[model samples]
Target chain A: MIKARVTVTLKNGVLDPQGKAIEGALGSLGFEDVGQVRQGKVFDLELDSADPGTAKQQITAMCEKLLANTVIEDYAVELL
Target chain B: MIKARVTVTLKNGVLDPQGKAIEGALGSLGFEDVGQVRQGKVFDLELDSADPGTAKQQITAMCEKLLANTVIEDYAVELL
Candidate 1:
């Protein structure tokens, strides 16, 4: 089995209201030094595939098809 | 400015309905050999502090106080 980690993050210049809210909350909680707080998603997947090369390609396809919204988000997959 | 990345994931044995849904979706989409899928959160933060040590401490506090639910989720902070 192969293990993979995928990170999906908003594109630069995209407005992230959730992240903004968190930043505000952090400030209210007395964490003043925090500047930009951008929130993203992470997925840890276990694949039954044997080859790492094929696994990465398959995972990338998964991202493009369902895991990520390619319109506004970017995804990166790391095999572990 | 110091940059840090924080990842928050559900603890083992915790029920993740969303992850389960994604797993099922993958199966339906013909992505066979996919085993377990777990979902998590990632935060990219830019701190105004110049010291990495202090920045990590502050970010950790942010995770403990607001970013993660200690009862169900575990968080890791990395300075980048």
Candidate 2:
């Protein structure tokens, strides 16, 4: 089996409310040093296929279609 | 500024409904090769501090206190 780790994060210039909330929470907790916090998504996928190349291709398609909103987010895939 | 990337994932054996939902979605979409899909959270933090060591220490504390549910999730911190 092949394992793929995908990280989907918002592109620069996008406003992230969750991240802003986190930053506010941190500041309230006295972690004033924290500047900006951007929250993202991670997916660890286990594939039945053994070929890394095919797994990557399929997973990339999966990200494009459903896992990530390509209009505002970018995804990176790592084969493990 | 220092950037700290924190990845929070569910512990082994924990049931992830969101992940399961994604799996089902993939299967319905004809990606039958995908077996297990685990969803997690990623935090991209920008800190005012220049020292990596201090930034890591603070970020670790953040993870323990608020970023992660230590009982069911494991978090890793990377200073970049």
Candidate 3:
């Protein structure tokens, strides 16, 4: 099986309060040196076929269909 | 300089409504096969040194200071 790793991130134009909140939390946690933080997600999909073409198609479909918000987020996929 | 890659994820106990919302959105987007969706973040930091030990200390500080929400998120880092 192919393992597909997907990451979805908020678009630059979108507001990320969660990220902001985390940034605040980190500062309180003794990481006084941290300046900024961006947040997103990672998805690991185990597929049946190892074919790159088919996997890419399936993974892209997964991202477009559910992994990423094309409206507010951007997505990229990596295969392993 | 060293490079650090950081990822922040909501703790399993926390409510990831954003992730849930994304899951529902994906279903509406025609990816009927996706089952569950979880969201997180990634950070790429350019550091002043390439040493692994120092880089790790710096990166960990970055995480504690600004990367992960120790309250609702867990974080891990990698060098790149």
Candidate 4:
């Protein structure tokens, strides 16, 4: 089997309310120096098949079609 | 001001229920080959002060103290 880790993150200039809320939460936790925050998502996937090339292609398709919001976010993948 | 991106992830061997749920979602989305999944958190922070040394120390302290549940997750920070 093969493993892949994919991360999806909003593009610069996009508003990130979740990240802003967390930033506020951090300040309450005493991280007063934290000026701004943006958040991203991560997915670590283990594949049933072992072929790296095929697994990557399938995973990329998954990200494009379902796992990620391509209009708002960009994705990166790592194989393990 | 300076910026840092901190990613916090569950340690290997820890159960990731959220990732599992997402894995199930992926299967429903037609990713039948996905065998397992794990997830991580990302924080992109802009610091109040510009000094690299101070910003790094503060962010590290925050991660250790509250931003991450250290007992369950490990964290890494990148300067920006």
Candidate 5:
């Protein structure tokens, strides 16, 4: 089996209110040196494929079909 | 400045209904060879520190204090 990680992050111009909230909270909690904070989603997937090439293709298809919102978010897949 | 990524994932045996839902959704979408699917949170942070050691330490502390639910979730920090 091939283990894959998909990280979905907001695109450069997308607004992220959750990230802003976290940044504000961090500052309140005394972590003052923090700069821009962006929050994203991570998916750890186990695929029943031995070939890395096939697995990556399948995972990328999965991302396009369901994992990521392509309108405002970008996704990166890594095989582990 | 140092850039960091913090990933928070449910620990072993922790119930992940969101993951289960995604798995089911994937199966319905025709990606049938999938095994376990775990959903997680990722934070991309920028800290005003040039030193990796101090940045890592600060990030870990942030995880312990806010980013992760220590009782049921674990977090891993990566400097990038």
Candidate 6:
């Protein structure tokens, strides 16, 4: 089996309220050195195929179709 | 400035309803070759510190205190 790790994060210039909340929480906890905090999503996928190429292709298609909002977010896929 | 990327994922034997939903969604979309699907959280943090060690230490503390549950999830921090 081949495993793929996909990270989907908001594109630059996008507003992230969750991230802002985290940053505020960190600040309240006395982590003044902390700067920007952006929250994203990760997907760990197990594929029945051993071929990395095929797995990557399928995972990419999944990301494009459902996993990520391509209009405001970007996704990176890593085959493991 | 130093940046840290933290990934928090469910440990083995833990139930992930979100992942199961994704798996079912994929199967319905004709991606039967896809097997297990685990969903995780990602944090992109920008720190004002230049020292990698200090940034890592603080980020680890952040993970332990607020970022991860630690009871059912494991978190990995990567400095970028």
User: Best-fitting candidate, measured by DockQ?
Assistant: 1
- Model 6 spans with C-alpha error above 4 angstroms: none
TM-score of 3: 0.65
What TM-score does candidate 2 reach? 0.98
Q: Tell me the TM-score of each prediction against the true structure.
A: 0.99, 0.98, 0.65, 0.82, 0.98, 0.99
Predicted candidate 2 versus true structure: per-residue lDDT over B5-69, tens digit per residue: 99999999999999999999999999999999999999999999988898899999999999999
Tens digits of lDDT, candidate 5, A28-71: 99999899999999999999998999999999999999999999
Candidate 4 differs from the real structure by a C-alpha RMSD in angstroms, to one decimal, of 2.3
RMSD of each: 0.5, 0.6, 4.4, 2.3, 0.8, 0.6
**Which pairs clash in the backbone of model 4?**
none
lDDT (C-alpha, whole model) for all candidates: 0.96, 0.96, 0.71, 0.87, 0.96, 0.96
Task: Indicate the TM-score of model 1.
Answer: 0.99
Residue B12 in candidate 5, Cα distance off native in Å: 1.0
Which 10-residue window of candidate 1 chain A scores lowest in summed lDDT?
Answer: A27-36
Please give the distance, in angstroms, between residue A4's alpha carbon in candidate 2 and its true position after superposition: 0.9
DockQ of candidate 3 relative to the true structure: 0.31
Interface RMSD for each candidate model? 0.5, 0.5, 3.8, 1.8, 0.6, 0.4
Clashes of 4: 0
Residue lDDT tens for model 3, B1-80: 56567877788778877767866776687655555566777875555564789778878876675566798889888877
Ranking by DockQ: 1, 6, 2, 5, 4, 3
Q: Write model 4 residue lDDT over B1-80, tens digit each, in one string.
A: 89788888899888998988888888898889989888998888899896899888988998888678988899998897
The deviation in Å at residue B28 for candidate 2 is 0.6
- Per-residue lDDT, model 2, residue A69, is 99
lDDT of 2 by residue, A1-80 (tens): 99989999999999999999999999999999999999999999999998888999999999999999999999999998
Compose the digit string of candidate 6's lDDT tens values, residues B1-80: 99889999999999999999999999999999989999999999999998999999999999998999999999999998
Model 4 interface Cα RMSD in Å: 1.8
- Regarding DockQ, does 1 or 5 come out ahead? 1
